[model samples]
Structures are given as structure tokens and as C-alpha cells.
Target: MAQDKIVFVYITFPNSEEAQKVGRILLEKRLCGCVNLFTNINSMYWWEGKIEVSQEAVLIVKTRESLYPEVEKEVLKNHSYSCPCIAKIEVSEVTPCFYRWLLQETGVEI
Candidate 1:
């Protein structure tokens, strides 16, 4: 595993309410440093052998790579969907100040 790698976990919610709820849970648990919620986004995807389109809320979760498993678990537990889109994308580059703040906010270095 890469050392001190930061990742962004993307998850889509049916509505802004759900997004805010899960975001708060993740923050309270210290599983993520920050969550940016984008509401009223249109998404089209294949589900149940059919194409579907809907307005969804997107959550951009910022956390350390080491905490991804826990983050996944929490999202699965709290999310409404049977199979939520919880994906972790690694951050290849981050400034020292922001990285330090992220680690501090997440208590990853404590």
C-alpha cells in the first residue's frame, strides 16, 4: 500500500436528505475528513436490465486509503440502496498543508 495516500469515495444518493444523513454519520465516526454533497445531478445507468435516469445527490468523501474498508462498511450499513456506488479513487497528488489538515481532521495521525 502507498504511504499516506488520500482517497475520494464517491457515492450517489437518491436525494439530498440521504446524502446529508450519511455524510453526518461518516463525519461523526471519523471515517472521513470531509464530504462534499452535490444535489440535483442527473444520472443515467443500467439497472435491472434496463436503462434508468434520475436526479441524484452525489457525495464526495475525503479520507485516508487505510480507512476505506471501514468507510465502505458504514456506507453499506447506512445506505438505502441494496448496492450503493461506493468507489474509492486514490489521490496521486496533494499539497502538504491540505494533506496535513486532512490527516489532522480525520485523526489519522493521532
Candidate 2:
């Protein structure tokens, strides 16, 4: 059993196709164990001093803190949205089974 904390990352994309790009790359590269894409999400934010709204898909990426910098760089470089949103939050705890599976999927060691 592993006692590792997971890092939760959030990223938004304009559409499903774009979101899939990130998902595929992350999974293929073993950067993330999973990415939950939420479609039909309405996002509203202020950009360049103006309010903007769009239909976006939210990506919930499951990874580790050590991978954040690279994960961010890859997404920012490939994402179509300007000034894309990327945020991270630390996981305080997780089930040992899930933690081990995450480690296995990402090829990370505890």
C-alpha cells in the first residue's frame, strides 16, 4: 500500500476535441492517471478588463505534484485557448487501493 498524496489539476478547453488532445497526451506520456472531462460547462471570466463567456469543457487531471510543471508546459503549449486556466490542489489523503492504482497507471513509485 502506498501513502502518497494525489495532485488534482484543472484545465479548460474550448471543446471536446481539444480536451481529448490533452487527455491523450497526458495518458500516453504517463503524466496523469486520469482526466475527467466535463462537457457543457459555461465559463465566465474577466480577460483584458472585459467579461468573457464561453462553452468550455473542464478537465480534472489526476497526477502528482512532481509532474505539474511539465504538465502545465505541455498543455499551455498545445491548448488553443488564450491564457488557458491551469490550477492545482493537493490531496491530503487517499485510499491505498486508489493510490496504488494511480501510481501504477502513471508509472510513479511511492
Candidate 3:
């Protein structure tokens, strides 16, 4: 895979406020070009040997694959959850214009 390929960092927060907080931090730091937040997402998963369900906010960060480590580190530092869900999804493709825009916004050489 290309090192500079765009990727989406998917994260879940306790609430929209928390999501927005971290999202802004990522943007301000230029770790990500943009973030899309979805609130009131119903999540069900296993936690501590039991099933848990909750309403959470999703923060999808658009950034370069090479910046995943920094983005994950920042998210871990600012996130409230002890074990926050931070997953990186490599984008298969994107529009040329948008890709260039993302690279420019993230300070990547286009």
C-alpha cells in the first residue's frame, strides 16, 4: 500500500461533545484533514465478559495512512474512554480533487 494513501480513522466517543473536542484537536494539530461526527449511534458490544449497549458518537477522521500513529496517539491522550475504539480503514479510492484537497489540508505534499 502507498504510504501517503488516505485513510479514515474511526473512533467512538461517549457523546457528541467529546467527539467534537477530539475532532477539533485533530484538526488543529493537522493530524487529519477533516472529521465527520455522527451522534446518537447505537452500539452493542462485549465488555468485561458481558454485553453492553449504549448511545455513542462516531468520529471519522480523514487523514493520510502515514499519520495513523500520531492520530491514534492524540486520540488516546484526549479520549475519555479507558479503551476507546480507534480503527484505521484504508480508503481504496477517492476523487482526484478531494484527494488532493485532503492532502493539502493535512500538510501532505500533493
Candidate 4:
């Protein structure tokens, strides 16, 4: 419980291809510990004063809160949307072993 430094970043992409690209970039750059992509989800949102709906892929990125800004920049740089959906959820609870693994993967020593 109380995983203060960990965060789950939620991002929606137009397709699995883009999601994979961005996910790999994040992993390679050590910006995130891991990324899980969920594909073929229907998303509806408002944009430019109109409603839009599409099949989208969502990426749940696990990382430290300290790296959030860089992660956002990386996603924005590779994203195709004029306005992409990027949200971060604080990780309130995590198993100690898994949390340590996350930190180690992201190049943080604990």
C-alpha cells in the first residue's frame, strides 16, 4: 500500500500500431517501467465543438511520477492526434516486490 512514486499513465491512440510505437519508445528510453496496450475499444469524445467516435487502443503505462513530464513529451511527440487523451492515475497500492521490479526496470535503485 501507498505507492507514492508510481503512477499509471493512461493514453488513447487511434490504433495499435501507434500505441506499440510509442510504448516501445518509452520502454527503450526508460521513461516507463512497462506498458500494457488494450486494443479495439470504442471511444467517444468531444472535439472542435463536435462529438466523435472511433475504435481506439489504450495504453496503460507504469512509471514514476517524477518521469511524468518526459513521458508526456515523448507521447506527444509521437502521437497522431491534434488533441490526445493522456491521463495519469496515482498508484495507491502495489506489492513491494513488483514495485521494486518496476523501479529496477526504470533504472532506479532502491
Candidate RMSDs in Å, in order, are 1.8, 2.6, 1.9, 2.6
TM-score of each: 0.91, 0.87, 0.91, 0.90
Query: What ranges in model 4 sit over 4 Å off?
Result: 1-4, 47-50
| Model 1 C-alpha lDDT versus the unseen true structure | 0.92
91 Cα displacement, candidate 1 (Å): 0.6
Task: Please give the distance, in angstroms, between residue 87's alpha carbon in candidate 3 and its true position after superposition.
Answer: 0.4
lDDT per residue, candidate 2, 20-65, as tens digits?
9988998998989899999999989887999999899989999877
User: Model 3, which residues run further than 4 Å from truth?
Assistant: 1-3, 47-50
What range of 10 consecutive residues in model 3 has the weakest lDDT sum? 1-10
Consecutive 10-residue window with the lowest summed lDDT within model 1: 101-110
Full-model lDDT for every candidate: 0.92, 0.87, 0.92, 0.92
| Span of 10 residues, lowest total lDDT, candidate 4 | 1-10
Model 4's TM-score against the true structure: 0.90
Assess the local accuracy of residue 65 in candidate 3 as a C-alpha lDDT between 0 and 100. Answer: 90
Total clashing residue pairs per candidate?
A: 0, 0, 0, 0
Across 1-110, the per-residue lDDT of candidate 3 in tens digits comes to 44488899899999999999999999999888899999999999988999999899999999989889999999999999888999999899989889889888988775
